[model samples]
Target: MDTASRTAIVTGGSRGIGRAVAVRLAAAGQDVAVVYSSNAKEADAAVGEIEAAGARGIALQADVADEDTIAGAFDTVEQRLGPIDVVVNAAGIMALQPIRELDLAQLDRQLRTNVRGTFVTAKEAARRIRPGGAFVAFSTSVTRLHLPAYGAYAATKGAVEALIPILAKEMGDRDVTVNAVAPGPTATELFFEGKSQQVIDRIAGLSPMNRLGTPEDVAELVAFLAGPGRWINGQIVFANGGAA
Candidate 1:
């Protein structure tokens, strides 16, 4: 792919890692559809940033876990900007709860958003993304660290890890690559939500880099995989600064 004017659908594109990916893709000359669950304002803001980067951008609403909504979101993007060349499934939620204290409600929500959401988003992308396209799914380094309070959250990302290779094989002849990016503790709101400064510092120290990741750190790899890294399929690339 030459990377010029390619269209992409980035789920959860309103903030954090998703927003960073959107900005990177746009700066790379790709039109982006910034999909969000409920925050139209944030989505619009992301699109604004995308347009400023010299590519067309649109805001769309879709619960990533819902098949119909995802399908519609893809359709809208293709209709408005043209065929989608990349699909980035970055919409997910994480809550810290050990196995002993895990709440069924939280477990169900995480399963729906992280596991089912990726499956549905990948399914739609498989059906619609143009030839020589790519799909970048998100995972986490915690899946390897076996963090205690991340049982349910890790389980959801584990399911994503299992799908990457299978989806790549299925898309073999189609020329679309499938892969997952597992990030370590990042400085995103999602990572800082409930943690104190001491806890954050402790987690950051676990990585050899002795620092937390930023959205741009993860986005760099995403831009590579979605752009020129077609040979890197069916693998989980850890963008965690060697944290795990």
Candidate 2:
């Protein structure tokens, strides 16, 4: 799709990679709706960045995991910015605990916000996005890395990856594309918090690039998928610096 013709809704766009993706889409001349569950200040800041890029920007708050909230959020976006030509499902949660110690509550939370959330968001996108639009879902390299305590989290992302192909086929008649981007260890606030310097260094060393991925790095890949990368559909593009 032409950048100028794009109108996108990015879930969890208030901060980190989601915010960066929103900014990048705006830079590419796509009007953006930045959706957030909370943190009005951050969402407003993201809107400012998008507007600075000379694209229409709006902030809408909703829980992507909730069907009603997701519907309401998309309605607001469509009302404010024309039909969405791009939908980026970047909203997710990560909680780590060994399988033996993993509680039902944590598992439910991850499934609701990660797997089910992606499903709800993409289902809505499938129904609402313009015929030639694109849908991008977020996955994680932890799935490939097979970390000890990340089984549950990885399962959620794995489910997302599994759904992309089916979604692509379902949306094929409309010429829409579906894909997922699996990022490695990114330097988002979520990754940095409670980590010691040594731990961070070790995590960085795990990647062949010898550094953690940045939000902008992933955003660049997302921009490609949203625009020129349309031909690449139903695939998991790992933006992990060759880690796993």
TM-score for candidate 2: 0.97
Each model's C-alpha lDDT? 0.94, 0.92
Worst 10-residue lDDT window for candidate 1 reads 235-244
Off by over 4 Å in 2: none
State residue 37's C-alpha deviation in candidate 2, in Å. Answer: 0.6
Clashes of 1: 0
Residues 166-236 of candidate 2 have per-residue lDDT tens digits of: 99999999989899999999999988877799988988998888999999999999999999876899999
1-244 in candidate 1: lDDT tens per residue?
5899799999989999999999999999999999999988999999999999999999999999999988888889989999989999999999998899999999999999999999999999999888889999999999998878999999999999999999999998999999999998888999999889999999999899899999999999999999999899999999888886
Please provide TM-scores, in order, for all candidate models, with all chains considered together. 0.98, 0.97
Instruction: Judging by lDDT against the true structure, name the best candidate.
Output: 1
